[model samples]
Target: MTLEYLDYTIVFLSLGSSIAIGVYYGFFNKSKTSEDYMFGNRQMKVLPIAISLVASQINPLTIIGFPSEIFVFGITFGFHFIGMIFVVLILIYLIIPIFYENNITNCYDYIEKRFDRRTMIFLKTLFFILGYLYIPVYSYISSQALSFVTTGINVHLINTIVCSICVMYTMLGGLKAVVWTDVLQNFVMFFALLFITYIGVTEVGSFKETFSRASDIGIFEVNTNLDITSKNTIWNCFLSGVLLFTCLIGFNQSCVQRIVSLPTIKDSRKAIILFFIGFIITVSIVCILAVVMAAFFNDCDPLKSGEINQSDNILSYFVQKLSINTRGIQGMYMACVVCASLSTISANINSLSCTLYKDCIKPFIPNSKNNNLIPKIIALLSGVFLICSGFVVEILNSTAIQIITTSLNLVFSTYASTFMLGFLAPRIHSRAMFLSNIVGFIVILGVIVKGQFFSGRVQYEPIEKTFSTDC
Candidate 1:
């Protein structure tokens, strides 16, 4: 068969497999009630939930964005993990136990019970906005990654196809299918990164040589200086990454939802502990890959090469270059990218569906109305949001990418106090929790509006362009 035909066949088969898995899980093995769909009957094993936790949070953005960050900044980017370790430990000892004890459906439900009704509503709305905004940035990045292999494909069309597939599995099979597929995709994604890193380092020469070049370029320094205004300084990363990852690991709906799926709180905590070990590997592996890319293509000067037009394209550039020599490695690489993207999108669609159903719809609908409408509305809206996100991703240009990722990170930062207080110190008033979510969201908006309208542009040129000849 011709190479193009082969590429087309592999892509179609891989995507088809995803759909078949979703259909099998949805029709043949679905839950009898909403709880099963949302939490896998709350009887999930530690290993699968552990795998899905890692898969869900580590999306295409990690595949593309993290390596892209390392490509430009080098080893200084690794310090973000310094904070992640602390955050993960805190969750194991303090946060996960609360959810396990309470048999919580939505994390926000705890906020209401511990705090007040208004506080619950406020926290959920804040998280919903934060999640919607943040997820699409990754969605847009995923679309762009596909564009790397298929040069002229429209990004919106790619997003539509991806988001549609994600919604299908999520809306149909629910978390069961999402987790099952993620287990398989995580292996695919992990091996793909390892393969790319190996090839990249070999292409460039020895690790010592690569590090030498990176140091000569001044990109290898640990950079422990403080500068809250900057994005990547060591001190800034340590401080902000603490809150950023705390929200992500401790309280974000995606991670929390998976942890609760365990058969017991102890198993849930075990999965969380295992996640930390895997997270460290994830951070180290990606950082090394980024450093390798820096060495291999350091001379290519992405901006000079015109590949730096968008920061998200950096990993794709490296992947395409690395795989160019082999017969179908490019196709396999692209499949890996698609799998990575769809895994997170799939988990989010499932999580968002559960959030809307258990947290929003079921809360207000009458007993009869709940039985009649909840599942149908869950399925329909999940499809709608995915389709809408596909279109929304198209309009997300460079500036939008920065605004969305940074803004969502900040919004979730608010959860640090709100969720921690609700879970650990239920004595905190509902008024305080409600006020905190509102204030936290306002703080994030205040920064954005102030920066956009009153202050001059934040001048967040893509990370790679920091070394541009013009600069």
Candidate 2:
């Protein structure tokens, strides 16, 4: 179990391949224009773009945090996948065609046309703020997981080194490089998940034992709570799942960039559907993995026994303990979490730089356009912000999933509701749209300030209790 030569080799190859992909694109497939740099000149294919879309969102949180979320909360969390249907419908029929037909580079461009410049700016501000909050937390989560493997390294050092590599590929290769890199990272992520799950389930004894233990312990208990403020309710998951994904696909500029990068509306719609299928498959693995974890530790319950006090540390502990008999998986697990962080950071900074150029810079600096250097410069500058902000992430006490989902859900929900109104209710006036955005912002901010800050650490009671007889 100490990460052996094979382990380190796997980790290095995973990281190295990501950087090499960037180098290939950076040198062989240089971006010739702003569109080329930002959207691959809208010439990209459906599958890679779809995979990149999935990979962009699948970070350490998805791999590390999601299982813990399901194990602790309940299997009802899977109900959120139901919301993807609404997400795809809106994107395919209501959203993508507009962008494709108009040849819009930025999703917010339509906002400016339909509403006003100020509304577009407001959404852009929220987008950058989200990137700032999310990328660092993701980096910190990766460092924490890797710390379990590479025990000698400082957390901050791990984050900086990995992120620097991500920035190098992203800056040189542009959108094309990031997409291809994501395609590679996505397979690694899935395989890692399945590999760990198989090892864990086998340790627990058998497939039937794992499922039986989970059921007997009520890890499969259903949550019926309909209150929106209540955490992890079937109602809330279903609703937030819909809104969160819709916003992610519908309005979030990073994801929107993926949709707009395709050559035609037909290709864009194909990507959207494929992204949904990919998303369903990923979540299915996480759900099964969570149940498997519950069964593997059924007798000794790591969280309750105080062996792994933190919820997020449970997987790391499981991997560490099981590695004694199995061997070599330590590096694969390391690659999984590290690549998760890399995919997330690369995609966000890449599109976020474009967000800055299109919304923030081009509007004010008239000469910024038709300049390939400016986009790369903006991407480089964003990378600095990405790394520096990560240093602040370790200070938070909550689990990575809680921190990310709370802030992201609040913002995305607001943006989802506020922005969708533009297309759904086209007759609405500019002033009305602006006021709607302000109200949505105020409301979401209130929820965060009151629910997250002032309240004594809010905890949602699990639907079913987990008992460890041996412990």
Which candidate leads the pack in TM-score? 2
| Candidate 2: stretches off by over 4 Å | 363-370
lDDT of each: 0.71, 0.83
Supply the TM-score for candidate 1. 0.90
Q: For candidate 1, lDDT tens digit of each residue in 354-467?
A: 777776667677663314235546655765675677666566444444656566666676667777666667477767667767877788877876666733555533343224
Task: Provide TM-scores for the models.
Answer: 0.90, 0.95
Candidate 2 lDDT (Cα, 0 to 1):
0.83
RMSD of every prediction: 3.3, 1.8
RMSD of 2: 1.8
In candidate 2, what are the lDDT values of residues 30-98, reduced to their tens digit?
887777888888889999999988997677888888888788887988888888888899889988877
Off by over 4 Å in 1: 1-10, 305-307, 363-373, 396-401, 423-427, 453-471
Q: How many clashes (backbone N, Cα, C below 3 Å) per candidate?
A: 0, 0
